[model samples]
Target: MLPDEPRSSADPSPEGGPPGCFRHPGTATGISCTRCERPICPECMVPAAVGFQCPECVSRGHAGSRRATTRFGGGLAGDGGLVTRVLVGVNVVVWLLAAYVLTPQLGQTWSLFSAGRDVLGGPAGIADGPDQWYRLLTATFLHVEWWHIGLNMVVLLWLGPPLEEALGRLRFLALYLVAALGGSTFAFLVAGNLMNSVGASGAIFGLIGATIVLQLHNRGPLAPVMAFLVFNLVVTFSRPGVDWRAHLGGLVLGTLTAAGLMYAPREHRGPVQALVVAGALAVEAALLLIGMSLYGA
Candidate 1:
């Protein structure tokens, strides 16, 4: 090349015609990075407030690029809460235990069986049976079928992040656990003595219900949430071997729980949330007693 002509696009232009890209010698670049003043091709350009930047300058802008957090310190993606993650982890761990260890060695005691529902009258049985009372809580975490757990987890993952961020960790966890209990209790109330069930559907449904209530309270769109609930309920009733009773129980309980949270006096929200949790436990107890009475009768 002559002295007046640029050797390559990567080299600086002669007589200010256009500078060659630093990285690609053959590509001519007219613009220089505001920070580095280096000639860069279109591919390397990173948009900035003042002007475009080269890759090196853009890479060091981590501090500037971070968006402000919410009141709860959540990130731009609403990812500060860990309660949802912990709930998922617990469910997965318990599922693994049930599938690999408990089911084989301990049998179906971990699952919710109608046998657990006890009565003081003619239904002379164990409210004290081997792990019977505990099954309501434990069954929520136990899923023998691969697809059962997979579908439940996918739904939880999709719904958990935003709800957890909105409600904070403790309240979110309370709602989920309570919903699980409610579902299992409902199942116990209706199922035959020989019937058994296990899965996280109750908890997943609870999250769905909670999300709908929360969005409604915030004056956000409601149609989508209602549609989701309606679709899932329809599927629950139509699908063979699916526990619609548990899903309905969970949805109702979750909706109540979220409503309690949203309506409480702002200064006393924590106490109200705790009270709602207590009420859920009370409802579970009441349902179990009713179920026991029916079984005994």
Candidate 2:
């Protein structure tokens, strides 16, 4: 009689295929890929060169497998942070509240409350009043409509998790917050006359920017990501009602932000991270300067 699979109950008969061993009689021999957690059957189970890996593991290896010249972090895959998820949750909640809580009258009244505006001029954004600047952050959590909220949440959720995993949670959160501010600041400068826009697209685009930088810095499975970014940018340009400027502004700021973070040497201790953070802020300040100049002129 053929030996049973390591985790399989059924034994392979003579006419059947190769012999297998069983570590568990009740369970099947199928195993999960060590890398991606996909299941792999016997025929496909190449002798674990390094060791036996299931299909998922095999595929992950393929996706992340770097060429000889690739840099570090090139073979990483999977979500490793919670910041993106929390942001997504908050955005979704705000959207639901916007839709369900607003009575016709309340909707009209609240529209002005949540809508973003230029604080320096025009209607002044929601938080333009004393101690209201917090709205700068809150407004990011707000969305104007179903489609607006839905699309943003989808992108935020999809991209946020993976990117956060790549960068630590705190760093990822910082990235999102900074990106949001960068986008808003850019909007404030570019929409100089009188314009108001609010959404999480800025922060979402920031994640995309980080992904792009990551691809450039360390080559790996970036084709899918690049494709996604290109498609979104195209849609932003092609479609009506899309704020491509804020998107692009966020993209540029985010790219720089990611680059700043990546280049800042982490070798130094306590003071080094602080220094890096400061440097990133200074870079952002410069960007804001550019925006202000553009607007002033």
Candidate 3:
């Protein structure tokens, strides 16, 4: 029998010999892999888009599972989106109302300060609600001057949509809020009592950290983002009043959180993600407790 001889379709075997599984020659099977056309028993057959294929043909390495994507992670974002747009809109509207209508008054409220006289820039000893608690998140929204808010908003506009798309509405929102919390919380504890902090640099830097973590999972281009992040870090530290500590806190927390998110097996994804988030928050809470012990706040 010639090796290249064409077997009839109705013959039920590759070479019309006794019908049996290719993998298990002793076991007979009528089914065959669609691509390789090797005989596959019911056990070896895996259902594919068109038909069953032998496990060997169907099995793709890590690269084969995902759809082809653009240079950036392409889970979504090309489509005009709601979450990112809405978030940006809120920031813009808030900035407009605060910057124009409310003016200096709004700026005073949305800055990081503890329960004491602010010796540096901010009004001394704001009311308890705005001073201790609200500042953490509100600080994310407020900026000192026009250039400050302008830069942060531009970055958010560019970065947020793609991220929101990749992470889904719930996960993305959770990440942003926590990033802001972690950043502000770090400032509250570590920064000197006199210093006041504002702006979304921490959250934006968190996005940078998330992007880095995601690259590990997806295996995308590294050079561009790395250079960009490094440049930003240098500028953040070198510039006056940058709150490098807030950026560090947000960056670290976001990276760890994203790492937990990407590392989880798809089957047990949610619970694993929750564990990571809870663990991160636990660490923050511990730090808060220590700060309270020392500082008596």
lDDT of each: 0.75, 0.62, 0.71
* Candidate 2, residue 15: lDDT: 56
Q: How accurate is candidate 1 locally (lDDT)?
A: 0.75
Worst 10 residues of 1 by lDDT: 117-126
- Give candidate 3 misplaced runs (Cα > 4 Å): 1-80, 115-131
All-Cα superposition RMSD per candidate: 11.3, 12.6, 11.5
- Could you arrange the candidates by TM-score from highest to lowest? 1, 3, 2
- The candidate scoring highest on lDDT is 1
* Model 2 TM-score (2 dp): 0.60
Please give, for residues 1-297, the per-residue lDDT of candidate 1 as tens digits.
776853655455666667777776567878888987888889888899987898888878775785553322223344544777777788788778877877664336667765433423322222433335787887788888778788898888888877777766666778888889889888777763445677888888888999888787788998987898899999999989888888988888888887886677766665776787899889988888877666633
Tens digits of lDDT, candidate 3, 76-144: 445535676776777777788777888788877677655433333332432233335666788888766
TM-score of 1: 0.67
Q: Looking at model 2, which ten-residue stretch has the lowest summed lDDT?
A: 68-77
Q: How well does model 3 score by local distance difference test?
A: 0.71
Clashes of each: 6, 12, 0
Ranking by lDDT: 1, 3, 2
Model 2, runs deviating above 4 Å? 1-79, 102-123, 126-132, 269-276, 279-297
